[model samples]
Target chain A: MEVKNTKAYEVVIDSIKDMVFKRELKKGDKLPTERELAENLKVSRTSVREAIRALEIIGLVESKQGAGNYIKDDFATSLFEPLSVMFMLQESSPKDIFQLREVLELECCRLAAKNIKDYEMDRLLAIISEMKETDSEERSSILDKEFHNLITTTSRNKLIINVLNVVSKLIEISIKEYRSQIIDLFKNDRKLVEIHESIYLALRSRDEEKIIKAMEKHYTLIKQSVKM
Target chain B: MEVKNTKAYEVVIDSIKDMVFKRELKKGDKLPTERELAENLKVSRTSVREAIRALEIIGLVESKQGAGNYIKDDFATSLFEPLSVMFMLQESSPKDIFQLREVLELECCRLAAKNIKDYEMDRLLAIISEMKETDSEERSSILDKEFHNLITTTSRNKLIINVLNVVSKLIEISIKEYRSQIIDLFKNDRKLVEIHESIYLALRSRDEEKIIKAMEKHYTLIKQSVKM
Candidate 1:
């Protein structure tokens, strides 16, 4: 972000943020040119360049070589940056990530139970049967992710879905080996399938208490595999 | 981030992430020098600088003007960048944000009920009483944030606390005028204090069902004040 002075850099950043917050900047909108931004905000062209660079770094702004800066259409990509930084800093433990997932995934189950459509229920039923019949661990893990994702999507809350996806990815990344260790346990057991079946059944029944209980059981099983 | 080629820049970025994910780089650790990184990754020095700059803007790394880059100690500040951008893009509505908060705050209530300390409970009691006595809308709002923060902290989950803080800040920012509209409703109504009292009382009881019910009522009231 081309700044020798952090304070001036931050001031320019805040000015751009004010523009966005006030709705002067919008989705798919090109940022004002460095010269125009400098004149508008009373900052140097270098400072404006640094501000645009900062936004580009966060995945919020894209600097096309000749076309200039445009805000990205998708915003969720920016969430991953902070999370990765947190993981790198060891600010959060593997267990902390899992606990947050349990908190969120349970809510997903609750909301999904209330909001599931008929076709979605049929799809869930078919997935469960296929899960029960599958002997491949790779397929089972893929199905596991799908089942949870479908429930999260059914919650009908974009924020919840987005946060859960980020947390789940951290779970996969931060505890990469342990997750595989848990999946490996399935080679000798059918308990994974049973836990998911209970979750599906709980959702089908549309009982909030049962859904929470079932989801808690699912998390409990997974938590056992986590050493710390 | 300086780059003419997004593809090469992305590759450099991914390589740095891989280093962090694998724990090859760590907190407060300086990144490899430009030439070193370029040589090691078989990429250009410009690509390495772009990658470092990308990390720098995300608050993961701080580039000393004369020295080099080191990872930042605090990671949570980085989260606001994306949410603000998302709010600017209208990817998430104020309603979606509040819904997510409800999901999290209710879960926090459930966990806090199990884990809250006596000192914290005593503190909450004091705040609630002060909230009831205070006629100032501003004071009531401050107490409101305190009460919610205490419960979220007591949940004893770092990831949840960090994520909730980010969402709560977004609610304050994205719905700045709307939030004041709700707070303005508190001038003639003691309903805000009463709602918080129910939450505090439920926590004291440590009954999961009561806690959930009380928290639901709390959110129901707030959601009603929201125009959309």
Candidate 2:
């Protein structure tokens, strides 16, 4: 910021970050304007503006039209931005991404079994029935994502939900990339539908062990089917 | 990046992102120069420059001095930068952060037990001994982070290790923030050392169940002691 650093914008970014980390600046606290930050840090206003823009994109700070920049507390949304970017940048193997999703989704199923609300269970059943009726692979895949999303939402842990959102998105991409192979491996959609039904029944029963076993079998089948 | 958008730089950012995500531009692919991007997007060169800077910070692109910008493939480092910012932005409770770490670290312990090498076992012992010999809280915490870092590294799962790196860093911040309260709750450092020792012994014994039990006990003690 003082121009002592060649990367002036990075210096500005780090200065704000250090203040936040040290608790000098906190969530919802308003930051200095671009000009003020530049003057304070002895860098150009353009550098400060660019640094603030970077922070905004990553969900660290939010710009509310005329209200300037304020520190943000939306962890999930903040995480979602990078999580999306990570999906594009990292070419993870089908196995690696799906395996991670399997672990988190299993936990989701275990928790969903315990914490899912009645309305959520109804929704899950509706989705399953919808899946059973759909002949289109695309439609079924959409419902598959929704089903897993609902399970994660039902887990009731913000941390788990946030992390799983990222992992599951990557798995979605992997599935899409290998759709033909997956369909070829699992020729009978009935077995797939039955697996979902098993998970639904397990959730309805609120049995964690049964839920885990059901969810494990479900993903293990997918893992084997998409043997990339 | 056109002036049609109020945030011209944002348009430029989105354009590049869309290209990368759509696979028009790929890892190590060079981006248009600031002048060319500005012209292509009908945005000012300053806006284009700012957009590229933002992308560089996020690890989506790298500016190699005189070599222009190229897409980056280092997923974990890129994720780490935003993650540290998220840690500051989200004031997670000790329980929230530790719970996430427990989930991931438990997996780490399980995998480490299966995958840890003989040299890693020696290094694990060395770190624990360093912790035992240290009287300073700062030194102990450093060794503690190193110890957990090693466990995650031993897991041999890039996704797990990357995610744990971010979580453990937040936990480090949480511990530092609550250091006084934690020290007051557990004045005896010996118990802390013993817990780590139990984990190391279990890891050395190569019993996954024993490793998980010892690790769970260790985190449970901390969770109880912190009580936040």
lDDT of each: 0.74, 0.76
| Candidate with the greatest DockQ versus the true structure | 1
Give the least accurate 10-residue stretch of model 2 chain A, judged by summed lDDT: A73-82
Residue range B134-180, candidate 1, lDDT tens digits: 87767767777788889999999777887886677576564445546
In candidate 2, which residue ranges exceed 4 Å CA deviation?
Answer: A1-3, A22-29, A64-67, A72-79, A87-90, A178-180, B1-8, B18-29, B35-44, B72-79, B87-91, B177-186
In the predicted model 2, the residue pairs found to clash are none
Q: What is the TM-score of each candidate against the true structure?
A: 0.86, 0.86
Residues A78-196 of candidate 2 have per-residue lDDT tens digits of: 34655555555555555556656766777778767778999999999999999889999889888877887898889876666666665655666776766556577777577777898
Best by lDDT: 2
lDDT of 2 at A30: 91
DockQ of each model vs. true complex? 0.51, 0.49
List, in order, the clash count of every candidate structure.
0, 0
lDDT score for residue B113 of model 1: 94
Writing each residue's lDDT as its tens digit, candidate 2 over B112-173 gives 88889999999999999998898898888778778888998898877766666556567677
Worst 10 residues of 1 chain B by lDDT: B79-88
Each candidate: chain B TM-score: 0.84, 0.82
